[model samples]
Target: MRRLGLLRLALGLAFVAGVSAARADGLIVSLSSREVVIASNYQGGSITVFGAALDKDGEVRPPGPYDLVVTVRGPLETIDVREKTRVLGMWINRRGRDFVRAPTFLAVLTNRPVAEIADPATLKREDLGLEAAAERRIAGAGERPTPEDAAFVAALRRLQEGRRLWREDARGVDFIGASLFQGEIALPPNVPFGTFDVEVRLMQQGETLARQTTSFQVVKSNFEARVAGLAEDRRLAYGLVAVGLALLLGWLASVIFRRD
Candidate 1:
């Protein structure tokens, strides 16, 4: 029985070694920080993603033309896209569409124009470009979208861009000496608190050679978390506390500025 156990252990080790050897020819990616805490005064921050390509023998590959794209996607949320039209000299809500499971925040960073790297179909298939990111849809109120819905979708993209919730930078990632590459992503103050996925793609001759992903968390600080919990768990007490604080501040301001 001891001999059989030893043989099984040896086989398992061999299998693991084979798998590691297979993965050694691809790319490896890393992030500087894997978690971020947002305080009450969190303005913004940035993260650096660095990676390198390895050959079959696990050594850095030789210099060559390689394209890199980095994408950061935040939590998903349902959004409503609405259009307004002037009726009788008053603007009113007209047509609207609901998009489910849309990314609350999305940022794309590329070394160069994505068009110069891959074709439209390839980009769409890989969801590499902003247009592909905005094409997400869920079951709507109807069977299919009408021709007029195109305008609404465009409007939604424009609104998101204006709010800085969505961003794309063509010259964001830079390759250093052919083997190593680095990219930076700026997290806005209003970045949603949830799990964010960071994806890195290595491409050559318009074909994706390797892809890797890492995740990070955006969480509220301890004080903010406690306050939010209080608000949700003890609504009346929280409201009273808020009111008391407001009154105390008002009185203090008046006392400081009063004319004798």
Candidate 2:
């Protein structure tokens, strides 16, 4: 994981440098903050991204000239979505699909409906929307998703959306000025703690003009972090301590409530 992160960082920097040397006008983006700390009272919040599209002469163009797509993706993981059936007055797992390399969280924000942003082929080529987010390997090593796999994919999407872990908001991006724009990515209270990659792509017609990638970290608060670390680092000790505390509390409760 560490090596992969370093490799991604190197590639991002190289991509940015190449774009800088080759293009005169493009997209510039900045987030409100680079880190989001999850507190005890964390209900929910939004990550604000401010950006602008530059013209050839280094000028901000009007809204119609370019379209912006903001995609925020959390760490990738495999998930299984199972289908249940009732048989003989009991519920049992019938079958399931394991979606590999799926984003734990996904948010695709656009200024307008994604259909108006580009053609389907173009969208697929650029990996622009919800479909793109789920277009990954299915089951084990098979990268192709069979036609019947659509239902599983839909179920997977439904489950994620229900948990507020995946969403697509057409109106999440707003144009503040000619070329200036801002986008808000919803971060649910139960958001996964990890590094999230934010990609802002500038599209004209059905072609991509420029893209900027950045990342932010979501982490636990100090006390929570310490507790999590203790649990992870000392499983046996932590389990013993937890059981002892529960037993102690139960004993005290019984002693105080006992009647003569």
Candidate 3:
């Protein structure tokens, strides 16, 4: 019994050490900024992400068959997509589909095309690519989508892409050195104000070796935030103040540029 106990203790220690070593060979990620502040003159901006793959000794791992996919998920909200048809003298709404909890902004950045990185099952399971990101929300309906539904999804992608709200790039991530990499996430002028989740995945041989999830926030400037808060908290005062500012600006503009 004493000998068996000793063997069991040794095995347990070895198992714990193995697990720790595996974790040590994982990925670490950081962002350039944790907040995206939108001002009145804000056009657009981008955030850079830095990452490193480390080994058991906390040293940079040697370059090998490694892959990284960075997916950004913005705030979720209800979205309604409508189709219009030409009628007698106007365009009329034909039908529409409602997407619940759809991401307001989404981008998938990868070192290379996802299809070349992993098998289809792995990609779908990890929601790594554009197609997977599009179908995932509705995939849990327990029924296969028909051709018409597929069209709606395609249309949705087209619309969001046009608005620059959804993006996918095969060559967005790049490795600077053996185990160091970086990628940039873009924010358009009309980017929604909310929290965004960033998911960083490290893959090897179609298997996810490491994963990390972090978040950042998008918000208006301090003045805008205070103004909005005031409006919400004191509607009457806000309205008066807004009107007063408008009138004052108009008067000053007319006086300054008055026929001179």
Best by lDDT: 3
What's the TM for model 1?
0.79
Model 3 TM-score is 0.79
- For residues 60-160, could you state the per-residue lDDT of candidate 3 as single tens digits? 88999898999999999877778888989899988677767888899999999989989877776777776666666653343466676677778888999
Q: Could you give candidate 1's per-residue lDDT for residues 158-238 as a string of tens digits?
A: 888887878888988866665766677788888888999988887898898888887889888999978988999999999
Q: Where does candidate 1 stray beyond 4 Å?
A: 1-25, 138-147, 243-260
lDDT of each: 0.76, 0.78, 0.79
Against the hidden reference, what TM-scores do the models get? 0.79, 0.83, 0.79
Colliding pairs, model 1: none
Alpha-carbon lDDT of model 3 = 0.79
Q: How high a TM-score does candidate 2 get?
A: 0.83
Task: State how far residue 47 of model 1 sits from its true place (Å).
Answer: 0.7
- For each of the candidates, the C-alpha root-mean-square deviation to the true structure, in angstroms, is 10.6, 8.2, 11.5
lDDT of 2 by residue, 190-240 (tens): 899899999888887868888888889999999888889899999999999
Model 1: weakest 10-residue lDDT segment is: 16-25
Which is the leading candidate under TM-score?
2
